[model samples]
Target: MNTLALRLFAIWLVVFGSVGISLASEFFSEAEKTIIQSFGPWPPPLIADPSNSVSQNSEAISLGKKLFSERRLSLGRDLACSDCHAPDQFFTDGTALNSAHGRATRNTPGLLNLRWSSWFGWGGAADSLWAQSIRPLLSKEEMKFTGKKLRELFSEDIALTQKVQELFEISVVDQSDEALFVIVGKLLAAYEETLISGLSEFDRFNVALSASDNIGIESYLATAKRGLKIFIGKGRCNLCHFGPTFTNGEFGDIGVTQFITKGRIDKGRYQGIKALQSSPFNLLGEYNDDQQGTSRVRTEHVTLQHRNWGEFKIPSLRNAVKTAPYMHNGSIETLAGVVEFYSNLDEERLHIRGEKILRTLNLTPQEKKDLVAFLRTL
Candidate 1:
């Protein structure tokens, strides 16, 4: 009932609102801040693989892009790299097993961020990207192309042969079939190195949060934030899915069944190590461009043991929402299924010496929903 009283109330409201906003700025706890900081500044530095001489060469990338889509690289001349790794589907074929040749045992992973990977394939079979590129071409379950077949193709295709000569400085007539095969792999790897994933909503949030700017991160959903808290906290997901690319880039057996049929067992990294060591195309082999042999250290000293029996490479979670049919066997069909698998993890199924990092999460239904929400932002 008085002008002075009304003015005083209005001033108090404004002051209280300002104080509330100030307090809200310190929303994240100290532990949460550290976790957020570790996630990134977005677009991590490109890792260099010295084993491939043309890893970053522009001409090699161009030739590789052309070659990646060339079906003639396969035995049947019907399957190309793009057959399993289609560009429109975020590089994944969205299938459990690649059936371009026959049905591949392992799931076809997306090719994004291969430059940062220390190893390639589900089992980490290849130490170098170039070597990994060559494996599928030679595998019976994949492209099934021999060195002789590839050599013949190169000799016959005048334009492709000329491009190879101009780009790699190798004469098809003079080079051995194996050497030509390796050269093609190197070019394919050069193109794959450029397939980096773009920034996501999570990356933007991390950038703003790292800078201590609360206003800049207003677009981030509250449910997603709660889910992120669960991910870095109780979910223990950060133990494997950490760093800028959201993966440790290592192998683990999280209790997924590895049996292909009745008697056959997919002895993942155990077999991978044997294959990598025996292969002539391995980084430690003569084909490696790195004369210094610095990149061969991982290959030379890699430990093989019974624990690696069912292990598979921990895939990067970037664009994981887009690439479905999760896991090495593609047994988990949805993101929700993946979350449920972790939540109700079967410890008995794991190897006796399997990773000690995993355990039953016992997440509430709401918590599982929140975690999935957070993953979608990636």
Candidate 2:
């Protein structure tokens, strides 16, 4: 024991700490940077929907918020849109399927970032957000109200009807039940469009990386960074889940079972396309707000084929950590389970010929954990 021994130990400690700090300060690799860049900048621009005239109307948004929480919108007066899309849980009721008149055929998706979506619903049945909003109100399985019932309810409430007239400048009493219903849907859509997700940890990371600030990178978890690499590279998750919202807003069939019940097979996009074409509330219909007929293009030219069978909309990954169980059927209970589903994906069950994007990842246990870690940051 001596002064020299103490000095040598102190030098060793300093050297070891310096090495650790250097490792922590390391930047992303060139290949990894390329992949990360593809995800683009975070907090994407707020794009208005041409199909919904009131999409940016403040008064409409206010009315829509009230209508969203109004239980009278449903048949039995037992449920409101808020009942399923609870604001507390990131607008999802945290159920695989919501039960109102009957069990919902699909999971209740979060309402955040609906303004950016080209289509709505798991099957993309509704070509516009307003059209999608009107669907559940008329659906026997959901709100369980006919156009007549909705019109009658509004007609009875003189104050409510008057307010609607003042805000929308439409005579609810004189308008046909269908026309009134469409307006209500449009108002609801206006409010829902405002439910944009806030900035997240990943978003901050992107900001830091873009600024070339070493201290900013410290805000993101190292484990999450590794997972992001896997997501864009080996996991191939970016193929379906790319963009600021971590979704391409397109439909895909990734081998998840399409059966909702023994007798019923949820045909997904195949049935959605058929329903969209037949829908009176569709974007191509007379009710569309777009005078230029530009917004109807997706619905007008949408191709329906056998390949669309069992395909479902790619859910956004933003706030995915909060909304679970996952998938159209809510078949997976946890984010970990979702990762596992893709990890050991059954290639045999997949429409390999139709959707060549999906394949069995065969991710190792560590890789699965890493992918899940990355998703949680979303």
Candidate 3:
């Protein structure tokens, strides 16, 4: 090993000698320690959603949780949001494309840590969590419920009707379909915001580093420690997948194919921008509860571009072990498959105007294993 590497090892020895533990995970430089510290202190602060009126209200969240699995909300009285976003499966239906309903165009992303996300969906079609909640309800391919259907369902469902009246302070029958739609969306968003993942083994390791608790560090998986170095070091995974929630909450084109069907290509953020600008529920629209006007800044200024055609949201990696198959359309079946794709990335799949950030990693076999071991701790 070189001087720095030897020093990194020596520091580990000195730190752990008193604790009487000798583990491969103990190696670290001051620089590496700083980078590792950036991962977290897990479970980031919950910011209030200015666009959703009932953002953190407990009553709304309770009702929304009930509504999440309420099958009657669908037109056919069959599908519910939970049907695709199964609660047991990290709130993600472990499928590439959810065919539980009609046929979804993209993978069902996990609901963990959504309160920290600035944008929602793979294509980022909505600006607020409430707006995104409204999507599956209205889509014919998902919950398959229209505003009119919701009005009818709420009218006859005595228990839900009573809950809506108590929380909203308005009878469901008195409200327009549009008003009811917004109300339900806000309620759901209030509940979805609570779906945060607990701290993982990686978080514990980060904490140990912060306290210089060498024995605590030794408890962390040795291979995972090496992998964590690769993630924040030469692999540069931290550039996109950094911070407490493990994502930057932005879109990117990482050479993943955008073809949804043979002829019907998923235009990703290109079409998402069009839909977002036109959506009546967007943060730029009248339904936004934020009176301060600052909450809509991102939605107000986003410009459409050709490069956005294939770009998709960079999802948080907190619950990666629970959410699969991976990628935008769920093309990759396993986490290792995702790693392999990046290891020998096919850059030709990317368009000329696409992001230049990605290149073939060409990771060694052992490197791939180490990297995957780190990801598991996430």
Q: Candidate 1: what lDDT?
A: 0.85
The digit string of per-residue lDDT tens for model 3 on 1-378 reads 999999997898787665545333347777888878887888777888888878889999998898899898888999888988899999988988888876888999988789889888888999988889889888878877887778777768888888888887887778878788899899999999988888799898788778877767777888898888888877788889888888888888887887777888888888889899999989888888899989989888999987788889998888798898999999999878988988887766654756667767898999999999999999
lDDT of each: 0.85, 0.84, 0.85
TM-score for candidate 1: 0.92
Better candidate number, 2 or 3, judged by lDDT? 3
Q: Which ranges of candidate 1 are over 4 A from the true structure?
A: 1-27, 348-351
Per residue, candidate 1 scores C-alpha lDDT tens digits across 143-249 of: 88987798789768988889788877767789877788899899999999999988899998888777756555655777788889899988888999999888999
Give me the displacement of residue 92 in model 2, in angstroms: 1.2
Model 2 scores a C-alpha lDDT of 0.84
lDDT leaderboard ranking: 1, 3, 2
TM-score of each: 0.92, 0.92, 0.92
Q: Pairs clashing in candidate 2?
A: none
Model 3: lDDT to the true structure: 0.85
